[model samples]
Target chain A: MNQRSQAVRDLLEAVRAKGFDPGPDGPPPDRCWHEAQVEVGDPAQYPSVQESQES
Target chain B: MQVGELIARMEYEYGYRFQQGDVLLIGVNDQGMGGPQAVLPIEQATVEQQVQGIHEEVLPMVHRDYRNLIMVRYEEFDYHETNGFHDQFTASLDDHPGGFEVVAQYKVDQNRQLYQGYMDQQWASPGLRWTMPGKLPDVSAQMRELGYKEPASSEAEYLRSFQPHPEPGFQPLDQEQEVSHLNRLAPRVSVEVARHALATTASTESIEQQAKARQTLGHLVAYDEDARDAVAYDASISPAKKDALVETYRQAPAKQRPALAAAAGAAWMMSGGGLKAGRAIMAHAYQSTRPSDRALVTAAEVATTRAHMRPEEIQEAFGKEIGTDLEAAEAAHQEWERLYSSTTTQTETETVVETETVEEPDQMQLALEHQMNQPPAPVASSGPEVD
Candidate 1:
């Protein structure tokens, strides 16, 4: 997915909605690639951190 | 976009000349070798900074033999598309053998988190995007509110939903159904036999039995002797029906298919017939493929290629693997091993294959005729095969 794509921006905004701090030095505490499972709210992914939030 | 435009944009953004031989920033994953990583196209993954909290879990599983296009071509970044994944998903990317590093930071802007990395010209291709399901089945109220959706019923349906899991731990559609027959029956054969046979099957096969199994069973591995054996026996048919089987499987509905045993007496004939035929077919399948595809890479190319790096980076990468990667790989390996064994123990008993049941002499004769009709095995004409 395009890092700068508007879709990413909208998704990032949603992720921001959940209250996150993307350290000035890093992308976001909960954000990494899909494989990382940090789950910055990409509905496109499954078996996510949200599962953790559920359990 | 074309390479020229891409390079120009990168140069403008990163503030680097990025001469003809500048480093190309390929795909990165934080799981490579130890602490947080950034797998680069160069030796030791060209990261000036080591990020925090990489998935140390993945460090070991990524050692690979294939030369990722990012490693070979600087201009080839376009080929590796970011599907639905985050750019810095793992914080460190290169977990493969040649963990990349910047030959010379084409442009290192401490302020802007930009490292101009470029690889050689060989990594070009059509853009690839990972096709993965948005999310796995969970008791999500959101999805529940949306309504219940039926399980997929066709290959096209699954493909549309098929999201390629980056973790090789999860069995892909083809392998999920594999009885790990090779693992079981293969052990019944010699290790040499199993390796030889697997190496023998050209990087393709009917795999219908297993593929169909995956489609129906949501993928499985029968680790124990019985289930593994049944899988192996079913897979034995792979050599005989490899091509036709694959064709049938591709079109096969994406659901459980009752084992279609011996569609006709001729099935055995095509499946290479009884014990002897099975052995022959297995041996051939185990052996390296005939006229294997050659890479045609030369030492000169290795030496002269821009892909080469100084001694320091190579040593660093090796150190990472020896120190952190081995442990990580072992962890992932053990986890998968546990998963396999867990599935194995939960196995319901299987019906014995009717290997000798009512062997029709006509079927045997047809098989013999079929063998005679086909050209000689590769062993007869050529030597060992390699890929």
Candidate 2:
């Protein structure tokens, strides 16, 4: 791979280390575009304000 | 790779060179090191110059922290139509590491109403989401307020309340009991009775009462497209009212046209001289409505003709319209077939589904049975008759 492609791979690795699976390669399916309900990134890091309010 | 490297890669791979007024929002909360930071693009600069500017201005703000970093860009998009400017923002994070995922995409009209964006229910943490802070400063403030406290209602609901409610009591009729009652009453009422009532009430009743009567009649014939068409085309109704209805359907937005086409089709059916006439009126309407656009007229004629004729017969049918331009006719036919054939098939499928779902009781048959079972009323009885 070229420099930019390698850089993207390295970025993906760092994201994976944060306990959030970025899913399989080549971007999530197009259905994940708009109105997708899947929780992305680390839920622990980006905690819901609703959960905070309830607690 | 670091955030700076990732930004460079995005420019190289996606060919999206940074433009002036584009802002990058960096969110970092690792090791208590960072809050939110905004990076503005360098004006009238080369790619290298902009990258150098970003390195100088933005890198130090994040304190060289790459982990737990989220980057989003707010880009101004001009769609080149009426009130078409919008601020489109996309985020690159753990979930969407390969490329940026569109987060907040909306446009504000002259009235400051928002349109075209995903709902909060689609997001796991809607409160944390950021809108365009540069163009719509109030929206950003509202989103931040939402992060701290519960909102009374969604932004969409607030905007929707301003629009005129076309059909009152439309929601209550969704209940099983209401629908069943309507089904029982529907067949007993003739189209002539409803039309006569509306015509008479148009002159005598108050505006509010007339509106209510129209709404009631509309609901009564809602399930029967043919009955609705008959009412619309009735001779007793004023010509101006008919013209107004046609104009309203014609001026409806393209996205709403599919739903409103039933009303337009009713007008076409009456004016076009029914199914036996075979698309000549539709062709005439298209020609008259948009005479300047030859391609649109050709496409509409082809689509309407194709609905009634076979593929082999389309050219013969089109001989009257195009007059020996076989190539152009073939091109228009192919284009419209590609666009509209699937839509026609889908509509037919939906009709079958609707027919299966709504069970209509035969009121005429039931009335006949009741008359057969009951005793007849006394004829010519001026006083009590002695048997």
Candidate 3:
């Protein structure tokens, strides 16, 4: 019933182990708001191509 | 955190003003990392840009690889405390799986109210627990796992969850139950009848019958009343019930709805027993989800309204012979014509009979005329004397 797949559960566990609180009690701290999903790939791999095209 | 402060923060972070109608994309990945990824002026963005920004860039970030792109038209962004401060914005979530779950909150002009996205899953209300179980049964458990305290169920809630139907016999419905019935039956009832039921308190029908009718009608038309009698409609009944009804109506067999709608419409009309009840009934029938039935009901409603004819009259004229909407409408018109013609013909026949009776000479006048034509009366008297 929990739509969260095993991958999501594992990610949450990893985030928790890394000292990132998922705020099971209430909302996470302001610092935690937009960091729930960390980027796994390198940003350099997908650089600002749109910006380069514009330039 | 007021509206002004939130807007300023958004502008500072995004380096763009999310003015009314500005398009923004918010992504939610498996790890739940999501924010406004791109902001573009709706006027400047093409269909392609919107699709890519939402589908390609944002949707992939959702918990599943599936695209659940949320689009917001920057209406008003604010901050509010609902157990915690929220940075909320009011916007249309384009093509949301749930049709138009918009949360447009306002207080004074520029008050601070945290922006909670339009989705109910994002809200912190305890009522959400009650509603979510019916929609996403696992959602409440997930929320509990996230450490939010689930509110204890109240006595009212316990009763509602375990409310038993009366044993076969009729029982009157209280206002709360009436509201429940109205919501449950919305999609199955005529929109006109449902609207009438909710808007007015002048019905002569029993409360139980009223509740059932309201429920059936409400179920048919997807009518939800925000305020009923004196109580807040939302507070009286669980949104879960309404959501379930809506979902059921959506998933119901499409082919059978028109037939059910026609039946419900007829029942409401009979209950009302008014001269133009058929019009209301047919109008409600016209709300059928199927296009063929909808068009037919519309034509029938028009014909009924125009000629003051009932469905019975149409049936009598056509005798199950009607097929298309045009034919039903034509039948109604022709039925009226036949009625009018028959009345006129009877009136003309009566007038002719009366005129002939009046113009024919009296008995005395006939005798006098006969005498004048033949020396008849005097000759009879003299012949009698001679004999």
Candidate 4:
């Protein structure tokens, strides 16, 4: 699957695991979801969008 | 007199039993206004006797549903035949028009006598009571194996440490699984949590300003206390809890503080994951039985159930689950009005949370029974107008 699909899956999995509904039961995730998809992508392409740097 | 005769006399003066007529010591009546004198013909000459009888009667009846109507008074007003209809509908505090006191227990009164169609004991705190028809029984057994003991309190307390143990029938995820699943994140999804985490980090950044700015290249979020104040919301984090966190950070030896903050920040950035994951787990936890979506569905069910009720009626039904916060009470009241809108005065708000426990069938044996079963509805679209 593409990275976007994977990220959504991770979130879905997390939500599934949590037994809590996290996604758009209300508003469409659209852009936010697209970004989450990118984050969940393969490590090489996504790298760590999570920076170690802190302010 | 003989020594035995003197001893007998002393014993007679000291020894006494609490006979029926013996005056009992009691707390003095603090009520400035004495209880109403018995208008009904009665032999009990004293008000104390009446109060004692009333107290005796009320105290013995085991508290049934936290509140009760103690008295109901009837008022008669003859319509004067003078001028055309005079308006007397409006009631003011100054006018003590004889009406029912509707005396509930003291604790019940303290909660403002709010009732919800469900949740009986919410006066103390906001409560969540749901019956999950899904979660497997073995999960509880496994927790027992892992020494997960539930607190001897409410059912929700049992949920404190939910380490679901079992050789999950579902296959474990692999590296490919990780890559495949990461595809679905909605960007800026949990910025709220991320922002909160970062905001806290910003306060403690001891590094140089430029370096700190470079290190944290995210949104420079500011506190909107003014807006919060405008809303008249007085929700301040208790200093004690924040101090505890700061202490935990400080105590973790010199070099570890940076790493701790980074971890905390990372955890914050992905906080949306936590909410999402939490909801999913809660759903799956009840999946086999409840077969539904997220917690919002449950909350919506509550909201919809109370939609038509008058504020007082709604409180009467599920007031126990609604906490003391005026905002919370108002929100609950609004939830009742929003979904259950009705012109007619609703006597009751019908809140029906299915209480049946639908035990999941034995997984090992049922594998073959429904192999070609229908696929479950996709999560994204199941909710009302997901887009």
Which regions of candidate 1 are displaced past 4 Å? A1-55, B1-59, B66-98, B102-387
Q: Over the stretch B264-308, how does candidate 2's per-residue lDDT look in tens digits?
A: 233333221112111222332233222222222222222222222
Q: Which stretches of candidate 2 lie over 4 Å from their true place?
A: A1-55, B1-180, B186-190, B193-205, B235-238, B244-261, B272-387
**Stretches of candidate 3 above 4 Å error?**
A1-55, B1-192, B195-215, B218-244, B247-289, B292-387
Candidate 4 displacement at residue B4 in angstroms: 50
**What tens digits encode model 3's per-residue C-alpha lDDT throughout A1-55?**
4422222233234434435444332111232111111111111222232222112
In model 4, state the lDDT of residue A33. Answer: 14
The worst-scoring run of ten residues by lDDT in candidate 3 chain A lies at A32-41
Give per-residue CA lDDT, model 4, range A1-55, as digits (tens): 2211222233334344435444433222222110100001111211211121010
Model 4, B228-338: lDDT tens digits are 111110011112212222222222222223322222211211211112222222332222221122222232222221121111221222212211232332333333233
Candidate 1 lDDT, tens digit per residue, B249-321?
2233322111111111112212222212112222221221211100001110111111222112222221121
lDDT, candidate 2, A6-50, per-residue tens: 212333343344444544322112221111000011122222322
Deviation in Å, model 3, residue B270 alpha carbon:
34
- Each model's lDDT comes to 0.24, 0.30, 0.29, 0.21
Relative to the real complex, the DockQ score for model 2 comes to 0.02
Ranking by lDDT: 2, 3, 1, 4
Candidate 4 CAPRI assessment class: incorrect
Docking class of predicted structure 2: incorrect
